[model samples]
Every structure is written in structure tokens, then in C-alpha cells.
Target: MAQSSSKRIFLCNSCGNEYFKWHGQCPACSEWDTLSEFHPPKSRRKSNGAPARKTTKLHTITHKKDRKRTSSGINEVDRVLGGGLLPGSMILLGGQPGIGKSTIAIQIVAGCGKSALYVSAEESEDQLALRAERLGINTKNLHVSGENEIMNVLEQVSVVQPSLLVIDSIQTVYNEDLDSLPGSVSQIRDCGQQLLNACKQKGFTVIVIGHVTKIGTIAGPKMLEHMVDTVLYLEGDERYDHRILRSVKNRFGATNEVGVFHMTSAGLEEVTNPSELFLAERTANTAGTAILPTMEGTRPILVEVQALVSKANFGTPQRNTNGVDSRRLSMLLAVLEKRLGNFMGMNDVFVNLVGGLKIQDPAADLSIISAVASSSKDNVIADGTVLVGEVGLTGEVRSVARIDQRLQEAAALGFKIAIIPKGNMKNVKSFKGLKIHGVKSVREAFQIIF
Candidate 1:
């Protein structure tokens, strides 16, 4: 067969738009300096007498009854994957460098009790072996390869006939036919497409490790994410010891589900009870600190919301936050000032969610306001008390979802009292040794807390 000719083109990394010539800014997305050189694969000519493709009816397609999921031998991982790993599905695991992306991949494939092939384009085989030793993973069923060429990697996959294949990074691998260098826009897209096709044809699960951009998205064409069956992001703060494996997209499972793990010398360890792990070091009766039961997927986690209110020395008061949105904090402050006559205008306010866990649950609104109020008044909320409600602009406490689950988690953790929205009182069930108080407004909540 004769080699097909290829043409050089420019592609926008942001929008995946092709251009015949380079431009300073992409005309499609208007992003500057995102255009990179690309060598697209030449299209093959079709014969004029080619046969028409046959389509299968959806109802006529047979479904497998005995097809069961294979567990990765880790409960937390299985939870995020919606039970276990599905055959022939491609998973994209992306995170910052040294955030345990590779370590977790090795552990998963090693524990799956199946023949696996791990191809590391970025690291040599010896380096991977040393890291595996550090992780204490020993398995004869796992095969290691240091090939960077996509064709050779696929060839090895064919020879090994493994049930699982891991590409240490999609960025480092390149196709020999493409003129673009590794990690370039064209190389990543072309290499990824080939890998996807191989995975589907060979009936093996593939986990592709990808590097994240400075803004924290997977550093590749947006199409890379769309091409995969699942997209997961490993996220954590550098100062914290815990890492969160969150699923942003899943075809076989639920999205936005999270699995918590603690970083250790032995690699990532599953955090069974994240609520207790997050609240292990709480100081009782501390002002500017409140507990909120927020749900991560179907699991409810109790995290501390801390606020600090101090006099502003400068002209403009600084509003700083960690693990909380600054705009939402400002809105809560405005509500406190307007409704309850509390003056936070001249105070430098800071709010933080403990354990480096970031939550967007509106149920945290009441807890944040309570913590701010407690700090401003120098009053401590009673110990063993939890808050779960959303604060509206009109100062009314709004109901949140899954109030029963949140309260049950609080009760299980020995919380004596729960301050919830009055609207949720109709659905509240009595828990032994736990008292529930329903408040209609922020003022009423303040009265109960202080």
C-alpha cells in the first residue's frame, strides 16, 4: 500500500478549529496564541461502487445478561466508577504533577487480578519498576513497556493480549505518520484516536493519564474529553494530605461523584469515613467555627466552616476565602448587615472550609452566615451543634435537598442539635439523642445559636 500524503495546517487548541494558515488569534474562539501547527492524516479515496453500511435496530440488539463488572480491588475507586470497571471503556485520569495520578493507576491495574499492560511514554521501564517497588505493588500479570511510539505500543498490546492497557500519558506519545512533535495538538488528538480505536477493537480497558493545564483542565484538545467514556479529575490542595477523585463525566455511572483518599508513604489510601477524617481535630466551643453537613454525591460529609472577623487597618476591607466562593461570602455578609443590623463593612473577613474540601452546596449559606456572625460578636456556638440550610436574600432560611440524609449523618457523628430550615420540618424524622430546631429566618437562627 502506498503511504498517503499529509498537509500541514494550524489548529486552535481551545476550539479545535483547523486553519490553513497561522493567525495571531483564533477567529473561531478569539483566543490568542492558541493556534499550533498540525499535520492531519490524509483521507483515503473511496471507490464509486462502495457498498452502503448496514445499521442495526436499537430494539433488535442483544444485551448480555451475564456481563458483570470487574472490580479494581479498591472500594473507593469502585464507588466512583459506579460499581466496577467496564470492559472496553476508556478512562481519562488527569491531575497536576505529583498528585498521585500515576501511583493510583499502577495500584488499580495491579490489584485488578488480570493481565495488564502499562506503557510509559514519559518514563523508562526501570523508573516505573522503582516506583512500583515504592508503592509495594507486586504482580506478574502486569507487563511494563517504555515505548513512546503509538504504533509500537499498539503492537505490544496485540502481543500481550492483556485485559487492561494504561498509557502513562497521552501527551508524551506520538504517531510516526504525524510530523508534529509529542504533546502537540495534532499528536495528542491523533494518538488518542488510535488508542480509542484499539481499545474498542481489542476489548481491553484503557486508562489514559493526561496532564492538566495551568487553569486545571486536561491539557489537550477539548475533543479528548468528549472521546472518552469517563473523565475523572484528581484534585487536592498542596497543603492538605487528602486527594479527591471526582468524576466529571461518566457514561455508565453517575457524574459529580467523589472518592476520598489520604496521601501516605504507601501511596493513596482510601478514606472510609471522610466525615470523621475531616472533623478529627475540631476544637469545641470556638467562635467563628461551625459544622455543616454537606453532601458529596449520595454521601453526607460533615466539614467545619471557619470565619475570622477583624478590624480593617487599610482603607478597603479585605474579603479572603479558601474552599468557599468569595462572591457568596460577600452576599451573606450583605444579608447579615441589612437584615440583622450586623456591621461587617469595616471588617476584614476570612472564611475557610476545613480539610481543603470545596463545596458549592447552597445549604452552606446558613453555616457561613452563622460563623461570620459568631466571629463578629465574639460568641461561640454551642458544641455538638450542626447547621444545614440556605439563606435567601430576603433573610429567609431556605430548605436544602436530602435534609434527612444530612441529619442522619450528623446524628451518627453524635451531633446533639441540628439547626435546619423551617420548611424542612415537615419531613424531619426523630433521631434518638438528637434534637432538631427549625428556624424561618437568619435572625431566628442567630437567636438559637448565640
Candidate 2:
């Protein structure tokens, strides 16, 4: 029989609550019965076979074979990953369900499709094969598994010894060494660590798929994110099939790069020209719609904004928006009604990003203001016109950051008119092809565009 020590029940590390015994839950926190009995550590496992590594000079560190990048068979993905996949690098790709996470991975492994081993903890072999068939990815070197056991993966690693290793999901993976069930913090951390160790020891590239929590952060403990070499987040409205993959952390490349993908019947298609997708749906000569050019990471793309105004029956009007912050919408409304005398307080206002894309850039200010004004006056702007600038609360148009990049994007998309900040004209290297009209205030911008 096990002896009890001083009736020493441990409190949850997350929430301070007393437990009579070690349990999976705390009566106070109500946190998935997460209360676990705390016991003194039996021992820490230490490795003894490897020689200690000495710190090398910076120039010498660049000569290693493992530092070289290998292509993932996808150009756009490679660009987002900073040239290509680095050997011994473990990347975590996360997204919501049905967001095509698996499709992207399958495409990535296609380059070495005939020379890699893929251990999928989430789906069985038959299901993976069916997906590959449907997607027309008949690669020779690819292997799939439904097993979640970590020991099985270790054995697979020994036999396959492929150039790349791919895991469908980190959540479904488990290790028999730990008594806790799979998908727990300890299990995920252990599994991720083991896989990373295997990759480094064998000199291979690895990719893991993770599911995002409700808060839009990756699931599992925060430490799991830190353990990976790079972290990529896939976000977009599920309603529209357009997805954006942004690099949040990269040990070897620029962190502010992004890759755009459009969901189609064939598979996830790489978006070569992102500008067309955002502005192609715009109606020519529409008053309540305006085009804005913004950059995600380093990729510049054009987007459109739309607004609608209707009379309010109740004393106060309702303000609603999609793809923009609700609190920011309220502040903008207050500014328009107070500074411009727009009489919008008694009207219902609706704002949308149009393509199911979420943009939180102040550079969209000019387009947003024009959209609101158009809705109020029921007047449409011009065809092939794009607006980019920040609008102050006093109805002044302020200069935005990276105006040149935005202009080049709009010009690339074949937009004819650009209503931009007056201050940007001086800094532009050359405006040879663009018709830019600079404005200092909201009134000036409206007058120039209309």
C-alpha cells in the first residue's frame, strides 16, 4: 500500500484551490478536472553518450550541411518559409477544421513524395490514400499511418530514414512513457521533443500540424510553441475559401512573410496575384465601395471596403461590422457624426471587408471613410479607383506607412485612380505609371475622388 504524506494534497498550479486528494479537477477552477496530485520527482533522465558541443564562430556555423535549405515542392510556401525548408527544422502549422491543413502538407511532401515517410496520427492509411487519390497526389515515397503511439513513430524513423518526416497532428500523438492520456500538455511536449530530437539526430526536415484554440492561439501549452523552430498561422473566414498563412516566428528567415492560398476543387492553389482576388468582385462606379491597398507581411495586396446606411426606427442607431473591429467602428462613427455632421447617429451602418478577409490596418482608413461618405450621400466613386490614407478624428487625412509599396500593388492590379496622402508624393521614387491625387483632409479626398 502507498503511504500518504501529511495528508499533503497539492493545489492546482493554474488556479489556487485546495484539493483533499490528487484529482484531475479543482472544485474552484472547474478546469476540466485538471487537479492532479503533486508528487516529488523520482529522478530526472539524463543522457550520457554524447560529447559536449563547443561554441563555434559565426562564419563557421554557416558551413554545416544541416543549415542548407531544401525545397518543399511549393514555391509560394517556400517563399513564406524564407527560401526553403531548413534541415533539422521543426515547423508548426495551425488552423481551424476543414481549413485545408492536410492538403497543404500533402502538397509540401510532394517534392520528395517518392522518398519520405509520413506518420499521420489523425487519419488512417486508407483515408489518407483516398485523399491523395482525390487530390491526384500519387507520390511514391510518401507513407501514411493512423497510429498515435510514439514508439511506432520511433521505429518508423529507424526503418524509413527519409529526407523528410511529417506528422498530421501533434494533439493526437501519445507516448507510453507518461501515464497521462494523449493530447495533454505533457504528452504533446514529450512527443514534440522526441520528434525534434529524431530530426536533428538523422538530419531531416519535419512539419507538424496543430489545431487552433477558440482564442485563435495554438492549442496545447504555451511552451509547445517555443519548442518549434518556426510557427505558422493560417487564418481566414471559413465562408470564403481564401486562406492566408503568416509566419509568426522563424529561426532562419524573415518573420513577416506570408503565403496566400485559394481553396478550389483541385486542391489548395497558390495565389500568385493576391491583388486580383480582393478587388475583382468590386462593381464599377459604386459609391459605398472603395479600394484599399495593404500589405500582409511583405506581400502587397489590394482590398475593397463596402458600407450601407439605412434609417433607424428606434431612438438610437445600431452599428455592426464584419472583418473590422467593433470598438473601432464605434469610434469612427462618433468621429464622422461629430466632425463631418453626417447625421449617422440615427442611421444603421453596415461595413464589410467584401472578400471574407480580415484586415486590421490603419492604411485602410481612406477607403473606409470614403465608403461611409458614399453610403450617406448614396454616391458612388469612380471605376478603377483606389484609396489609401489614415483619417484623423477631425476629418484630416494623415499619411500612412509604406505608401510606395501600397501604390505599387494598386498599380500592379491596374487601378487607374489613387487618392493618397499629400505627404507621400515627395517620398515616391517615381510615379511614372500611376495617376496619384494627393489630399490633406477628408473633404479634399472626397472632392478629388467623386
Best by TM-score: 1
Residues 340-421 of candidate 1 have per-residue lDDT tens digits of: 9999889999999999998888999999999999999999999999998999999999989999999999999999999999
Error of 2 at 408 (Å): 1.7
lDDT tens string, model 2, 1-450? 144543344545345454557666556666665554433223433222234556779888777665668887777788889988887789999998888888888888886443677788778888888888888876788876677887678687777777787888888898776656777665776788878877776678888899888878877766677878999987788678888888989887778688889888878888888878777777777669888887777777887889888999898888888887777777677777787777786898899988877777877877887898898898988877889887788878888888888888877777778998888878864555679888888788877876
**Which candidate's lDDT is highest?**
1
lDDT of each: 0.90, 0.78
TM-score of each: 0.93, 0.86
Location of the lowest summed lDDT over 10 successive residues in candidate 2: 40-49
RMSD of 1: 3.6
Residue 198 lDDT, candidate 1, scale 0-100: 77
Instruction: Give Cα distance to truth, residue 396, candidate 1, Å.
Output: 1.7
